[model samples]
Target: MDGQHYMERYIQEVVRRLPKGQRVEIALELQEMIQEMLSADGEEVTVESVLLKLGPPKELAKKYRDDRRYLVSPEYFDNYLWVLRIVLLCVGLSVIFSAVVNFFLDPKQAKEAAMELLYLPSGLLAAFGAVTLLFVILERLHVKFEPSQSSPWNPSQLPPLLQKKAVISRSDTVVGLVFIVLFCMLLTFAPQVFSLYLFSDSKELTMIPVFDMEHWNVILPLILASMMIGLVDEVVKLVTGRYCGAVLAVNAVTNLCQVMLSFVVLKMIPFWNPEFFSWLRKKCDIPDLLPYITEEAFSNLFLGLIVFGTALELGTTAYKSLRYGKN
Candidate 1:
């Protein structure tokens, strides 16, 4: 049989066991190699001769089978993953609880006045989604190899456009670095305003605002905190992109520190405890609500929600990182 006929049979033999996308790509590449090797004017290239020249079809199939276009790790997470959920849940629950309590404590007159300018949870999701998209796009366009060490799964070299950008895009790089620094600054000091929007009241809208601050104090700061947390998440993505697997463990400790500190501040305040109630009551007129908040029932529910939430986020992030982390 001719080279064309040989290639057709060879591809048919090899494509069945592979994934559809993988099969198609291998078939197309193999067809091209065969055509390049034996043009129409060439001596007859039988299936046997072509097979001999190209090497065993099983070996060829094995090569392609071993390759990975995008890393596919099993959804495996250990202790580190659970800790993240703990932190996020704790912070979310505490903030939500604080907002609800502070709002209702105000008189009904102050309620309507502040309703127009409260924090909305939707704003937090939007900010997080937007920033995370930025990283997702960058990850897709990136080259996966250095000049000296490479694989077929990795591009042999960076594209001309990316090479040019690397050589001459100092300003863009500097600006990106600057923005990252600014985002971290926001995360560290005042994470509350990241989601604050001067949202105009609309006839079509019916959602109630959550915070009741005098100005944007409640709405703005809560937004900032959500955005800042999202920023830290993106930072984790960026750092982990270069080194997957064990490298991400750095986040575990940092997150634990922040979560532990927040838990202490929220839960261990002496004045909120009735055992120290007399000293606190005389000092600043310790409110009944503060003591109530420390009660076992309330604390357990809040802590449970926090732990559950943190678990969900950690599972999510771990799965996501495992899928997209390695370049």
Candidate 2:
């Protein structure tokens, strides 16, 4: 490649590692800097020599970011903010949803519904703390979105411009993470809410608890751990913002942990409330349903579904990683 091609390749490699919004502006600045350096050298210095003296595109990109002083660091800051926004959105929506549900359930208790709004600030604070903590851990571990700094880089090693398909969607990852967080929160704070609500003849509302509280309490930590593994997996996706072997490996490992934890939870005991089935059968007048959908049978069915879902996720992630990793 000639001087122009060399410069373009170098600029592309640097900016492509950065956020999309800043890429154009940074590319222009880099081009101007390279031109100034070339002009200063007159006709004696080749573009290759100039680039070599400037060092690798990766290092130059770091200089452009000037991200050395922070706990999370600049490279990961954009993603940190992205995750924070999604978490806050999820928290806010949960508060609103809770308030709305309470209001609909009992108009006389509108004051109580209004009181639920107080949880908003606390929820947002918790969300911020969780996201910051995750980023800090990543930073401490030196988890990098860019290629590792241990490798040598040269002008010839300039990576090609990123392809469209190689990019992971922030929105999609956010949606998935929001669901995971909400599910975790629901189980932790209000597991009993997963109940069958009924209206009695006297217009009294009745809630039949789904899971035996004793059993749920016993297994809650394991379930939360499983969910946390999933949370970490999504964090990896957010940081990398693209498909790669690392993402595939993390996905596989986390999914496997989730599978094992889920199996353990299912095997420890039947989670269903002992009274729930009897009440359900009485209410529905379907005593025969017990034979077909016993606790053991339900546990087996749930385990099978979890295994199938994990397999599907691993397969999809593998295909995407391999297809885009080459790019």
Candidate 3:
């Protein structure tokens, strides 16, 4: 390729890594700088030589970035990978241990125990994502995990102090996504496992399902859809890495959908276990407690809490995004 093409490719590499708003200006500036350097020699200097002096495109891009954030920069990349490997190994081993214990606990539950092993991949994936996200946030926050042992501690020795910015807490969002995944998995495969266990005086065990499995099956799709929306919202927040009207808007829409799905689950469908109340009456000595506690009443209380939580999240996001969105 010609020198001009090489220069164009080099500029494109650096500018493409930048935000869209800065790309055009930065690209033009880089072209001018390269041209000046090429002319300053007063001889035909190869574009390769000029590019070499400028350094790699990735490093040049980093210099151009005002924020200087990286997912896992070279300095801490080794530590990040170390932690990631440990996390994944721990997650895998824990899943295996749980599965083994479950199998031994009830030898007849072999199929059920096998199902537990299926979670290993998801658990490892979540662990990997969480660790990577934590590192990314730490990078953006300019947090140092490995301070130099050779040098004495001094304020001057510190890395460039990062300015406080309105960034979406990527770690928290990842955690939320993990929980959503777990919740959806539970509802999808083993929701019947969520039960109230009672042991009689004779050591007899009784299990009462938490929700009417029949009705739960009916609303499962809606619940899953709402959760999927929640996942999308978190992913958007993760990508944006800053609170703004767009994030707030997404939060508002997802929360609304969740609230509606919750309403349908709680009010329209007979979600609670039908025999749960009767079992309580039969099994409990506290008669007065049973009188005040009805399925409808419990549903209403849960719905109210969901609404309250939604309101609080929306309010907080609005305050932050509106206040510091431009920043």
Clashes of each: 13, 0, 0
**Sequence-dependent TM-score of model 2:** 0.84
Error at 33, model 1, angstroms: 3.9
> Can you write out model 2's per-residue Cα lDDT over 1-327, one digit (the tens) per residue?
778888888888778656567889999998998989988989888788889988887778787666566777766788888888877887788777777776776779899889988888988898899889999989898776445656666677765545678778878888789888888767754565688888999988877788878777677888889988998999999888788888998999999999999888886666788677777556665666757556677788999999999999999899888987653
Q: 141 in model 1: Cα distance from truth in Å?
A: 13
lDDT string for model 1 (17-97, tens) is 345456778788888877766665376754455556665444466566543343321111111123233333433444454
lDDT of 2: 0.81
Pairs of residues at least 3 apart in sequence or in different chains that clash in candidate 2:
none
lDDT tens digits by residue: candidate 3, 140-186: 76643223346432222222212245667756875776667667655
User: Which ranges in model 3 have alpha carbons more than 4 Å from their true place?
Assistant: 1-106, 115-165, 283-288
The lDDT of each candidate is 0.42, 0.81, 0.71
lDDT at position 260, candidate 1: 53
